[model samples]
Target chain A: MTIVEQPKASGTTGGAAPRGALDAAALRADFPILDQEVNGHRLVYLDSASTSQKPNVVIDAVSAYYREYNANVHRGIYTIGEKATAEYEGARARVARFINAPDSHEIVFTRNATEAINLVAYSWGRANIDRGDAIVLTEMEHHANLVPWQLLVQEKDGDLEFVPISDDGLLRLEVFEVLLHLKPKLVAFTHVSNTLGTINPVRQIADMAHAAGALVLVDGAQAVPHVPVDIEALGVDFYAFSGHKMLAPMGSGALWARRELLEAMPPFLAGGEMIREVHLRRSDWNDIPWKFEAGTPAVGDAIGLGVAADYLTALGMDAVRAHERELVAYALEALPRAVPDIAVYGPMDLDLRGGVIPFNLPDIHPHDVAQILDRYGIAVRAGHHCTMPLHERLDLAATARASFSVFSTNADIDALAAGLVEVERIFRG
Target chain B: MDDLYRDYILEHYRRPHNFGVLDDATTSHEGSNPLCGDRITMQLGIRDGKVAEVAFTGRGCAISQASASLLTDEVKGMSVEAAAAYRADELLDLLGIDISPARLKCAMLSLETLDAALADLDASASPAAVAAEEPA
Candidate 1:
């Protein structure tokens, strides 16, 4: 609470207009990329789960860093150098506050969430895990969350256990406890499934993992953009997320580990920065987050990410969430009506899922469906969507997915339904 | 519409030609675009140095299925050696549309399957050790 600063919203009192109330139609203007056409129709960009369209503020902020203040951080005593270092550290502080992190030093900048997980696997796993250790992962994790631990487990000759997912894409918590009984060294899983849209109980899982003496790491790439997250409240040791998926530039992502854990771990990469003193054979590492950040970082991207955090903060994550929850519920009902015999995968209850929805038209492959939808200028994702294990678990070859964001509306859902109707007419006629 | 050849693509997808498994396949191989899970199993029956029978059985997109459906007619009575030597671009050009670079693999899946089947035939005719080098 010491670091948190927000104007208390009196929306519930029915007096003042809701603070940070998200007006998606009006908010759409903030994102310049959304006001465009594709294939002679309005671009119904539904692939925000892949990467969010950048807002004007974020884009301008990124360019401003290069145009106004361009210098290497922590090196020169010149004005621009000092400004660059200040902006970079300022961005780090904003990111820290965004996730309710107690200290900015806990956040380590990486290329994306994938690299963040790889950092933990390479640095912390190498230090902590040994041969014959047990690691538990879920069946529905994106490859980013799954593969790094896999490399570590494979290297260590450790046992890797998967908490299986049900046919509807929900994690079987009973199986998770059974795997936990094995006394795994770590439990690495996604906060939300990219394909299935299943939102796992992170706090509960973290509590269970900690009780069993296992460290917990969450892949919050899908979760952070659409939902409100407090890593401290979740009680997870490590939280990884991407800036690109949250309306920032592509090269910005971060890892937020507990301060003590970061202090104890080794540097992920060795280079010009991230060092206290370097001799020919041996070099003393720098401080916590800087120790993990190796080279000249993506300073411009970090600036963009900071602006994006501010953008989301203004819109209010709770309102953004409420907007999506209503939009997705409408999509689930509206899609089946638009196209007969359409099948959607994930929990039916909106409480158990996020805005991402993966679906299929009967007998028509996901690629063909996506291709036809592309004609209508509706960009939806098709194929395995980097959740091959989850697809395999559900015995599905592929699915066509449309994920919503703050700018999404019921009209987008209607347009998607209409586009799907076109898909059905072409493939089913 | 939209300048794409979706009409004919849908036609072949709806009523794909020679889509049943061949009863007497001399060479058989399964090929898949692992990225999209587009699998095609091509079978050929060669007699008197010509392809006496040709068929395929699998599931995938309209382009992949239609591409295979169209190619079954092209190689039905051709010499087995000539069919085995079919070039990828020839098959692609025969599709009668501008295939995007992303979907070139879907349009050429049948040819790759044919090449794999021929490679399997080559390995079968040689020593057992040749089978060890087969593609995963």
Candidate 2:
């Protein structure tokens, strides 16, 4: 019962012409998964916030790395090993440039953004944070950014405070100031809320935290894929993001920190390649970045992430931002109009949000909504989105979220709206 | 109507039967599907070795809520042992729909909670006898 038909092209404002700087129709072709059909309908993937579909270039890059020159990096003297090493290090350089970090040596490869935050919490928090110090977080942080700090503060006998979010889902700056008055040792927050899509003022927060004698760690897992992030310009000590959220393969992510901080922090894990000299009972750790990256890394996936970075650079992040904004604008207007009694979470202003839209219909559970949408071949995320505290704050058990990417189009939004109508008919009729 | 969300499913979901706590409950148990945030607290009133009343309170999707409704109706007059031995397939057959593997937990949550309540009864009757029945 597969219906291989072209997507509907006559339903929305962006249907007749390209809405933003990027031509979404042309860009959507690059993702082969978008061309297929599911359950007698064209697949409309609105779950990019969970993980983006890889482009052909990223797929080819990873395949070519394995098929052409596959070898262990940093140890072998053969040509293949040297090539692999170059590609692996080249990825770190590309990621460093992508975030405009001061030095490539500041970038450390990690499993994902969660692991990156854990690395900072363990290697940096244990070294500097004392028993009486405090660590401040935000109510909107995902578990990846929240749990590690909670565990760290618990272990160090320090206090953990959260800056509450307002009714509009924006962080209350006054409350943040009050928390800052506690003279915290470190302040960690998400650059964009994965559940609410609220974009925080990163540079301003970083400045305030620095003035309060605290280091800043920004979880850019939801920001780096949709917006231009200059880590040095933002004046943050550490910025972490995952590659899978940005059209790259999983098992590849980077944590960008100041070179001096990386130099001072102990190695997160002890194994080969992270040590300069080993003895029976003691060992001298390696230099910056490699000191954090112990044992063999995901070389092929890193190269694929480099290609993904190159692809985004080639497309220009400003254009990507513009495209997603238009899609979100269309969604914010279209979803509520199509389905009655819909409640949307997060800031209503377009400037304050990213591509993620979390919402719920009256008396309809999010899982049921997602299941109904799935029948139409429309994919969406439904749950607490790993922000249970925020969901509790909002008085909701869960929400249905539709996050956009560069390949998303107005027709996809139309399908989502139309699917909600079906959901309404099924439940309310 | 969709096969999974049939008319009866929606009706039961909108106005679930026996959807509250039993004040004189003899056995009670709670279960949760953490992945989807579906939760159920099932309570039973037993008299003369038979199930006298059944009630459940929770929030979840249509399948879970309606399945809970159907379970309470089916178990109201049954004995404790019969309710404990009830299989999951019977509930699915009673629902008259095919549930995807991803949603199997939602459909089986009520049964699991009911099983837990029966297990609690078994545990409280004679702790040493139940402990000795275990194969070490």
Candidate 3:
């Protein structure tokens, strides 16, 4: 395979020659967190599905926001507030373009993907969803998407249906087709399974759901971080994602909905900055996105997310996708060889899935496997991973997970493979 | 790694203690740390108002399994009051290693589960009778 050079940092256009085909050594330098030692070995971060480590560029951008342009947005007449608002709204525009939303007004800033999903569940779901009206989801949804709907169903007396995944952990779209025939009011699913690493056929699902007159809400928390997504192209009613999963600081996320739908949905949270006018008796809500954002939003995190998006953008989503795909393929091949007893979860085909690798070693608990991996400075997640329903379907109590990002390399997979060997040896002894 | 990953912790994790449902449990409860996904199901056999037998079964990491084993060992033959007050610090101390604050719950799951069972016992019983049986 020909090695493609990593593009130079977008901020430093024409500063130096682009580094050669970003192998482990070159990519490791970009992440400061990977430099440190954990439990005596050099850190091998493999938990990007939970949260990715920020490059120096993203870290500096966040610090720069607080140090230089720290001010309240949308209200201040001063220069600082104006600058802050520009960058903050600029971040919104970047998010809009990143997902190819029709307009910036369609994007609502949120604390994280949890809050994003909650916004839609409360606002649109509360108004439109009714008693016995069905909200369909897949067994593979993370709790962030699942719990809010459960709460809504409890309150509104609605039925929550789950589309089952196949034995291989792929979404059983045949089951989804059956559910769609029932004419559900709304359909919600994860774009990628966080635990199984299955990339859902969301665009196809969206078309089917829309044709059946159901609104679709996609939890893009896992998908957006690993691949390029065009919301307009996907034709979903709402899409939600978190910044922290994409190498930005925590506490940043976005909820994008169509102009008509967002305008129709009620205010999720009602407080200052969200109301157009407030009286003791009643208050008029603000416009589409602001009505949903009640508090002083995560301003700096938003700015940092913009920088993070730019970081990936300069690298090109196609390149990022290609890099992570290679890493996932390497991991899938190496992991089985490293520990033959290991049971790899999710779809067997690399071409059909995202970059998360979840597996279980026989006779060893996932947590024990995770602890052993930690000794080798490999950061992997263990246990049910907030996908208890999916686990129930798979009949597994837990599985160890190693999720990859653009910065991850073949050597990181090698480290995970090596760590698994130690895990097996220790268990065998 | 200088044995920071303790051998005993690994041993218990590989071959967990009280790994199945107790045949004669007088009291039982299930507890889980939703954040880290550690789970424990504790079953107790109480004789004459003391913990005569303590056992637990569930899925978790090393710290949790070790903690359950250590907790069961510590609580055996102790009155409910004595076992309920088992400090979080002492459990880590018994492990002979420094655990992250996030993982502190992982090491304290059994104690918490046991505490909840004790609380249920108190809730179901008369207040005056429960107060009269307090441990010194």
C-alpha lDDT of all candidate models, in order: 0.86, 0.89, 0.83
Give DockQ: model 2. Answer: 0.50
TM-score top scorer: 1
Runs of candidate 1 exceeding 4 Å displacement: A1-20, B1-5, B127-136
- The docking quality of candidate 1, as DockQ, is 0.71
What residue pairs clash in candidate 3, if any at all? none
Q: What is the full ranking by lDDT, best candidate first?
A: 2, 1, 3
lDDT of 1: 0.86
Alpha-carbon shift of residue A313 in model 3 (angstroms): 1.6
lDDT score for candidate 3 against the true structure: 0.83
DockQ of each: 0.71, 0.50, 0.35
Q: Can you write out model 1's per-residue Cα lDDT over A350-385, one digit (the tens) per residue?
A: 998899999998898898788888888899999999
**Displacement of the residue B135 alpha carbon in candidate 1, Å:** 23
Worst window of 10 by summed lDDT in candidate 2 chain A? A1-10
Candidate maximizing lDDT: 2
How large is the interface RMSD of candidate 2? 2.1
Local error of candidate 1 at residue A239 (angstroms): 0.3
Q: Can you write out model 2's per-residue Cα lDDT over A1-429, one digit (the tens) per residue?
A: 011121111211111233337888888878999988888899999999999999888898899899999998999899999999999998887777777776889999998999999999999999988898999999999999988888887888989899999988999988899889999999999999999999999999999999999999999999989987777678999999999999889988989999888998988988998999999999999998899889999999998887787777666677788888999899999998898688999999999999999999988999999999999999999999999899889988889999999899999999999999999999997
Superposed by TM-score, candidate 1 places the C-alpha of residue A109 at a distance from the truth, in angstroms, of 0.5
Per-prediction fnat values? 0.85, 0.67, 0.41
Q: What TM value does model 2 have?
A: 0.93
Can you tell me the CAPRI class of model 2? medium
Rank candidates by TM-score, best first.
1, 2, 3
